[model samples]
Target: MAQGKLERTGFWPGDARLVISISMQFEAGAQPERGASGPFPPLDPKYPDLPMQTWYDYGVKEGIPRMLDLWDRVGVKVTSHMVGQAVDRHPQLAREIVERGHEAAGHGQTWEPQFSMTPAQERAGYLASIASIERATGTRPIGFNAFWLRGTPNTLGILQELGFVYHIDDISRDEPFTVPVNGKPFMVVPYTLRNNDIVRYDSPALTVDAYLADLKAEFDLLYQEAGRRRRMMSISTHDRISGTPARVRALETFIRYAQSHPGVRFMRKDEIARFALTAPGVPRS
Candidate 1:
């Protein structure tokens, strides 16, 4: 219903029509345990559920290695939204992501909802996460995607104060945009869950082929639209889900399919943030 046009000098580097960003959520130590089978899942952990925790570990060990190899072979830069605790636990994991030329963004200190927290608690948690990332990866995180895309009212202000360049929790737009925070620019790199692999967990479709087809279809339509002007596609991936042996093949398939087309560039989220500053039609505050 909102019809518009984005007047600008150019769309992207090299005048590409579409920008593709692949984000992998690295939440090895941040996922909460299975709670009681009640209306609201209680976080009262009575015991250490080693099995569930090990399932997440698979992402760090087997899944991450596979993903690294595949992405390296395909020559793509990704944004890894890693939990601070996970980075603390496996410092080398974050190091590997950075050494391989990928962006490491802050997911959370622990994978918990931030919408209910006080501003002070949220600030403390984010600061802790930033410090952990710096310690492990040698560079502070510049982008953020809170758990479940939830952020407090002061989240944007906090990010600005902490020197972040962008936020990806907002999925309102298909292309990158900017927001004015106290006269400073806060870039928003929108993320999508419709094309995400998490759909396989609860959606009606039961097969990987179906998932792959849907992803291709979405890309095809977006690519078509981008021809009129520049557009961006944010594909959300999870090391624990897409990194699994069975699902990773489909992911690689999608990557290869997207690469086969012209006018497509795979970028890191940080790159999007920096480019958005100069992008056409973005707010200048």
Candidate 2:
């Protein structure tokens, strides 16, 4: 029903196209230990360092280049959800994303937890993070995706207050939809737990075949749905996993397959947001 409602939106006027968005989480200013308490630590043993030097190196040096190659091949662009400090540290990389034509949005100062913060503190944290990103790249982020998928209850209003167009904080569905702000609609493009590589860290060895198989199934299912009505799908990859040689092959396969497909359009998060807002017969309610 939601997909049917969204399908009325014009896509290439006739044929279906896929718009792919690549969101990279750049968490350089890490405070994994911030939540520690009097007798214990915040970053429990279970949540060991998610972004270590090895992971960072894979993202910046090796994986980004491969991702760029895939983008070039597909004629798709990314909307990098960079951590504030990552932008500061990776000015050249940030410039390159903008230099080529992708949007550079905020991820956060560090991949620190945010769910427990007070509303005021959360707003302050957000502003400070955005300021850091802007200071480094000279461009303010128009979108927001909080680090570690964490946020405050007052997240949406605060984002509006800060002039953000949309946020990827909600992972309720696969399709791009909108949320209400004072009865004014805003985008809530979907994200996922099953569609991410983070699962690899949780259990089992992640292989290229497994990743591509997951992607292939999702794409096929969504593509099939396009025959009846319009649909959108999303997948996220990390440099640490995707950039790794073991997983990179699967990524390459998935990208190439999507590129070769005739009906899909690769686009960024903002593009989908704009489409949802203006598409005919669609409910921006």
Error of 1 at 47 (Å): 3.9
- Number of the top TM-score candidate: 1
Off by over 4 Å in 1: 1-9, 33-45, 283-285
In order, the Cα lDDT scores of the candidates are: 0.82, 0.68
Candidate 1 lDDT over residue span 1-285, tens digit each: 234644332578887877899998887766666541211324458865556666687789888878888889899999999899889988998899999999999987976678998888889999999999999989999999987788988999998998989999887888888888888779999989887766453454557788888889989998888866668888887777678776788888998999999878999999988988886766443
Clashes of each: 0, 12
Q: Residues 81-103, candidate 2, lDDT per residue (tens digit)? A: 88766666677877777777777
Query: Which portions of model 2 miss their true places by more than 4 Å?
Result: 1-17, 28-52, 283-285
Candidate 1, residue 94: Cα displacement in angstroms equals 1.0
Whole-model lDDT, model 2? 0.68
